[model samples]
Target: MMYNATQKVISLSGGREIVIETGKLAKQADGSVVVKQGDTMLLATVVAAKEAKPDCDFMPLQVDYKEKYAACGRYPGGFLKREARPNDSEILVARLIDRALRLLFPADYHAEVYVTVNLISADKDIQPDALAGLAASAALAVSDIPFGGPISEVRVARIDGQFVINPTFSQMEHVDLDLIVAGTLDNIMMVEGEMKEVSEEVMLEAIKFAHEEIKKQCAAQVELSKELGKDVKRTYCHETNDEELRQLVIRETYDKAYAIARGASSKHERMDAFDALEAEFASRYTEEELVEKLPLIKKYFHDDVLKKAMRNMILDEGIRLDGRKTDEIRPIWCEVGYLPAAHGSAIFTRGETQSLTTVTLGTKLDEKQIDEVLVQGSEQFVLHYNFPPFSTGEAKAARGLSRREIGHGNLAWRALKPMVPVGEENPYAVRVVSDILESNGSSSMATVCAGTLALMDSGLKMKKPVSGIAMGLISDSATGKYAILSDILGDEDHLGDMDFKVAGTRDGITATQMDIKVDGLSYEVLAKALEQAKRGRMHIMDKITETIAEPRADFRPFVPRIVQMVIPSEFIGAVIGPGGKVIQEIQKATGTTITITEADNKGYVDIFSQDKDGLDAAYARIKGIVAIPEVGEIYKGKIKSIVSFGAFVEILPGKDALLHISEIDHRRFETMEQTGLKEGQEIEVKLIGVDPKTNKLKLSRKALIPKPQKA
Candidate 1:
């Protein structure tokens, strides 16, 4: 029996079409779909366990986005010729899909789900990231899994004062706003993008425009699900919840939790109060009774009672857990040049969140090389974020980088990347490392503030000073009432309806990320949130400017000195001799590092050294190699060799001139030895003339010497 292949096409606002086809491949999987736009194609497959593990409490969903080398018709980059770990871009795309779909899963349905989307074909014009989220959602739509999705993802870019949905790669270059928005038919679930300091209204309009196109794709997924007879989903009871225990915990803990939330003034104090209340409730139950019910009680009390209590305190009383009113920001303070040896350092503290960031300036040799299948290049600026367990008052051992760290670092990187000066304007490669010393709120935003200060402290002349703020939203869709929070605490982010972070300068937003937890989040609410965010960002920028108004006048003394120059492309090979002999010799002799590259038919050379002497030495060597000998110019020369007729004198590092016996002195000499210009001796010589046809220089020490009658 042969099954007919079904396909559906959704037209975007810009006339580009995404074709989703099913029943063509991967029949063994629970659900699979191939999504194609232009020449790019992505194959997405989703599989779920029949029953969840007994101990599972949350949705164990994992989404992986892989770009195969063969997809672009190229071999793998490394020596093994195989794809290895996922690159940063791929991990980011996978994260976008996970964030959008994770909230849409059924509350009690905790079966392990794995969604894998692989790029099998590539088109230079179309970006693969925009297609990844849609492919993942389509696979889940045709599956018999319990999901609230049939969602779609689209890339929205503002070009030439017009918004283009699903813009091609080339179109992105001209857009001031490049955002990827994911949502169901009614509301947006996730938004992540960078902009050129656009206004609040402009950003909101882009989102609204993206939602209109997304509605069509969502409708297509719904129809395809119906066609596959997957309108009804599978059932799985993963929770052994006790209704009686849940009510008892709520009844006993609601008032106590409310008091804890309302009375506490600080983060640690509020947390301690909540912890004591939970402990008090547990003490009432015996050890044997707790063996079966303590976990359930704790879960229900914290997740249902405590969560509701905290949210209500904000929604009803219009006060945050820390006793701040809505639209209020926490206290902020900043300091620069915190480290003596670092090229640049800053410490930014907002309420309890603190980031100690340092900036390291390097040469082009230090740029990070990216070897991903789709992208092969180097980045001159990089940002890394580190969050230790001690930052949150925990005692756990340190683990390597987590996805949260990567995500936060990426956000801060975007916020500050555009302000950094490019190649010729500033030739140093910059790396910023943000270490969270204390965190009770948005440490990622703290990173942005600290990074700006650090870059400025390092003497980097950025386009502008940047600051960031994280905004929180708590709302009730039924009542149409909500509170927009500024500089929200960690609790607010976990319990609120939205976690929206906006970063920029005084003009507009540079980067933004919003993850909406509640449904039916209207554009009006989003616009209000953006407006609130702007005020908060402005306040933070004021604090940042108070600490340091602009980049420093000079770098710290310990930083490496980098001098750059451009030479004719023809001399590049000569400067870097066969097997890199020339450059290596220069580095060995001058105690410096040299790197050269050909760009635009010119050789760009960067020389780095630690001391003034070393820098001057390398600089002189490079200047000599590219210099043209000027007649009548004087130079301190070393006699390389003496012959019968003349001696070769080294005038410059790489230049030599002929010094005849007669040119050595005005007096006549019988042989070259009579001139007494022995090898290993230094003398001052003048470039008198050059044979135009031979390109050979003629030097004379007699020109600089005083003659008996005419000097």
Candidate 2:
């Protein structure tokens, strides 16, 4: 059998080439493509249902990104020894692809589309995530699906002040700005990344640089698609449109919806008014005639009338739905130390959204362990964001962690991670949990604010307070008119052309996420949005600082305290002992927890205890274990055993020496019994000398007795 495959190669800076090929693997799928760069390869397949599900007025696109353990030549961790549920990293990648692809589908095409991108091969240098989006888009291009894109994604890193596309894992370490940008040949659709307090101008430049590369990759896909004769997409009637009903619904409801939007009422109030207007329109039809007509009525009123009214209201008038002018922020209130029992706690409320966040400090054992195929490590600073049903006034049951939760939490984590102190500056593992008690829009931004306050309340000295704001854009391509709304409401986000979130400190941006829903979104608009976001962030920062200017002077009294010490690497084994016997005994005796790790030729020891005395005792014990004894210093010793020639005395927790009878009181004794020293006896002794040949300590009991006061 013979297979026909079409391939396209895109050459990147530094002479790196990415090969995208189709028709050679997973041929039975509706669309399949293999994207390869160096040893890294991803197999992306997309399949769409032949017909849309009944009453499915929205596109149901599910994107799954998985990495096979075999890709990296490693077995999966755990008892199952197989891949389980998608990890946070995988979900984040899938979200990037889904956000870009979901925007390119035809608005009328409501088919159930599934896109799967799997990392079949791995390379340490080439990150597979940046290629996954390209692979998925290419698969769609080669299929007979009604997709409006042959988009591609690229990761741009500013290393040594130079923009490099799809940088290696090693190069990422030095990057001050790291962004994954996805776009079609004409416009940028999605961007998400973290920065090291970089300026907005620098970030904008990086995005522009990434788009040039994405355009090249997208063009290659178009070329490949034409070669395979798959340029023409299959047509399907997904919607039974009642043109008369659509126009009638718009004609009747558009004015009412516009009035409600212009009223600038609260979120629920506005929602109620819109719902009532739609219900009033449906009241004209009989219940028997409503079943089929109701769906279209709601769809038309929502997708066309309400959206248009909101966008036009914002574009025509500077007033937003909430009555604020463009670039204006919502009201904000903040409180710290709201929870007494928590190590740190805060409540941040901006407009209708509210976040209750708490901070917990723990030992090294509390760090989050990450065991993904390409990433393996532990995180000292962990942030979790949760959005419950009641947050949005929804009556549905709260299920397990959703991809939105992971993506939002990761964004907050990135925004705050750069400020969380690490290493010797902070000795405890930090965990920040933000629960959205109430939400309208930008719950993730609320989380960032709450997390910052909670962390500071916990007495963790953050480098600087970070604040985030979500910006919305309403633009008319024909009129060249746009309005950039600051601190947008949830409704604005749903109806706007862009949802752009920027998080940072007073100095510069730290993290950002943007998704463009419309074409012809210019860089100028983004620049303006970023600037407006910065101002909104600063306004929010004022509220944050008013609540708490800085981290507490110290941790609460009840909070467990951790003391860190560093010792020579050679002493690590002695401190741990055989089977961890030494460390366990120390912990049990001192009522503390001890952890020891070696790095850079030194052992880092941390002792954690709620009781100060216990913490001090554990510190002293470990200090003694690693302490090197001097020949002339005196030490309190414990008699361990006695022999005819001498008694074995422990000078430290684990250090022992021989105390000869002659050195006991400067007198010679025939037997050890004459010295009156017994096991378990404690006495003071002087470390007089060390035997060079034996490398043993020699302790003298009478060396400090004025030596023959006989003098």
Every candidate's lDDT:
0.90, 0.92
Q: lDDT tens string, model 2, 1-711?
A: 598877899998778899998889999899999999999999999999999998998989999999999998999999999999999999999999999999789988998999999999999777999999999999999999989998999999999999999999988889999999999999999999999999999999999999999989999988888888889999899888899999999888898888998998998898899889999999999999998899989889988899999888888878788889988888889998889999999999999999999999999999999998988888999999999999999999999999999999999999998999988788899999999999998999999999999988988889999999999999998999999888889988998899999999999999999999999998988998888888889999999999998989999655799989999999999999999999999999999989887789999999999988999998989889999999899999999998889999999989999998888986778988788889999999999988999999999988878755564
Tens-digit lDDT string for candidate 1 (1-711)? 587788989886557789999998897899999999988999999999999987778899999999988988899876899989887888899999999999999888888999999999999778989889899999998889889998888889999999988788777779899899999998899999999989998999899989898888999999999988998998777889899889989999999889888885788888888888888888988999998888898789878888889888888998778888888888888999989999999999999999999999998889999877767788999999999999999989988888889999999999998899978888889999999999998999999999999999999898899999998888877677789899988989988888999999899889999999998877888888888888888889999999999988887777898899899998887788789988899999989989887889999899998877988888888888888889989999999999998899999877889998888887999987677678989989999999989999999988887887965
Models 1 onward score TM values of 0.94, 0.98
Instruction: Candidate 1: list runs displaced more than 4 Å.
Output: 1-3, 13-15, 283-288, 631-636, 660-671, 681-694, 698-711
Decoy 1 TM-score against native: 0.94
Q: After TM-score superposition, what is the CA distance of residue 422 in candidate 2 from its true location, in Å?
A: 1.2
Model 1 residue 459 distance off true place after TM-score fit, in angstroms: 2.0
Q: Each candidate: RMSD to true structure?
A: 2.6, 1.2
Q: What is residue 656's positional error in candidate 1, in angstroms?
A: 2.1
| Clashing residue pairs, backbone N/CA/C < 3 A, model 2 | none
